[model samples]
Target: MNKKTIAAAFVAVVAAAGIAYWSLGSANAPLRGSSVAAASGNKVITIWRDPGCGCCDAYADYLEGNGYVVTRVDDPNFDKRSIEAGVPQQGIGCHLAEIDGYVVSGLVPAEIIERLVSERPDITGITLPGMPANAPGMAPTKTGTLKTYAFGKDGVTVYSEE
Candidate 1:
């Protein structure tokens, strides 16, 4: 190939690599809401969710509306991270959150989260399990009840019901 063609090819490759790097790097970056939380002196909660999960975004909004500073991180492997953080495989939620050294999984209500933070339970974390129809991020229809479980070295146990 001519010098100009080779140069153009190299430039294209470099541009593609840069774009890829940026996209991948941003997956772990904190969402824009984090800065607002910091400025308002609210408690910061870092949540890891799968990319393009609208429910997770709604949950974050709920948390923010409830006066918590939410810093969201898009992680495709959020379930794995939740399990690694002491959540059982069966207890994996739509998202994983870290607040006040506690692991909160799924679409737990803000009230329950506040209680968890207030009571300072001895468990490693809490989980709401799978997506429920009437959960905070789900549709606004009341289901029978929602159960939040606490899991640690001992095992999973009923934490609360809402």
Candidate 2:
């Protein structure tokens, strides 16, 4: 072959090799592994809430509507349990949830819960204090003035204004 012909063949070979490597890397790439249930298409989230709390049930329904297969535990000891689980009084909400490994409390929005699962922040959990009317499962009131807080061992801080 002429020198130019040989150079063209070499470039083609290099391009082919690069394409092959890209395809293999793409095929063997690791998944995000955010939700164990999402891998199997179940997308389940476990929740613990007070039995008599109507808003807690409403939150569960909202989660269910947003693709979470909710397993609710209505324990009368919800207050004690949340405290035991590291949820502070100032950070209290309507219910407690475990999504993947992170904690979710009160009437937090479904989108925020999804973000928590996806981002996996190094915190105890997220909370919507006092069940604001405009929060995910809370009753819609005039102002919708619920305050959402993020809680961890360090302390609680307001996360969002609802």
Candidate 3:
């Protein structure tokens, strides 16, 4: 090929690579939090997630849509933080959250969260464990039952099955 054709080909390849990189980077970028304050009676939930996981953002959206005021923080070391917050290694989820005084892990359902706040269970927090495909925010529609476990100074125990 002529010099101009070769140069054009190189430019095209470079442009394509740049676009691909930007797409991936933005996908993993930390999500911005909502500026709107929660209404008088709304519950406020703060979630910390790995910036590389898209599902965490979806989970935040799920919380917001369910009437909770959600705040998201992108922490690449979220798992370590979860452990530090008393979540067992085996019970770690994709994201970690603090609602009222309890730590919530993974894609737990909104109603369960509401129940936690209402029941005021004496525990450090509740977790849904690993990323279940049918869990809220993980899938469009939930199917089957999801067992949520509570962990605290005592130990991990079954919180509920929804």
List, residue by residue over 9-95, the lDDT tens digit for candidate 1: 999999999666543434444222232334355567888999889999988887787887676788998887777788899999999
Candidate 1 vs candidate 2: the lDDT winner is: 1
Ranking by TM-score: 3, 1, 2
- Candidate 1 structure lDDT: 0.80
**1-162 per-residue lDDT for model 2 (tens digits):** 999999999999999996665323221222112254544556667666777988888878887878887777767666666676677877766776666656677777877776666676778788876766667776542244556677887688776664
| Candidate 1: 10-residue stretch with minimal lDDT | 30-39
Worst 10 residues of 3 by lDDT: 30-39
Pull out the clashing pairs in model 2: none
Poorly placed runs, candidate 1 (over 4 Å): 1-41, 141-144
- Candidate 3 structure quality by residue, lDDT tens digits, 1-162: 999999999999999996665323332333222212222346787788887899888888988888887767778888888888899999999998877668899999999988988787899899999999999888986788999999999999999997
Maximum-TM-score candidate: 3
Instruction: Give per-model CA RMSD.
Output: 10.0, 12.6, 13.7
Score candidate 3 by TM-score against the native.
Answer: 0.75
Off by over 4 Å in 2: 1-35, 38-42, 140-146
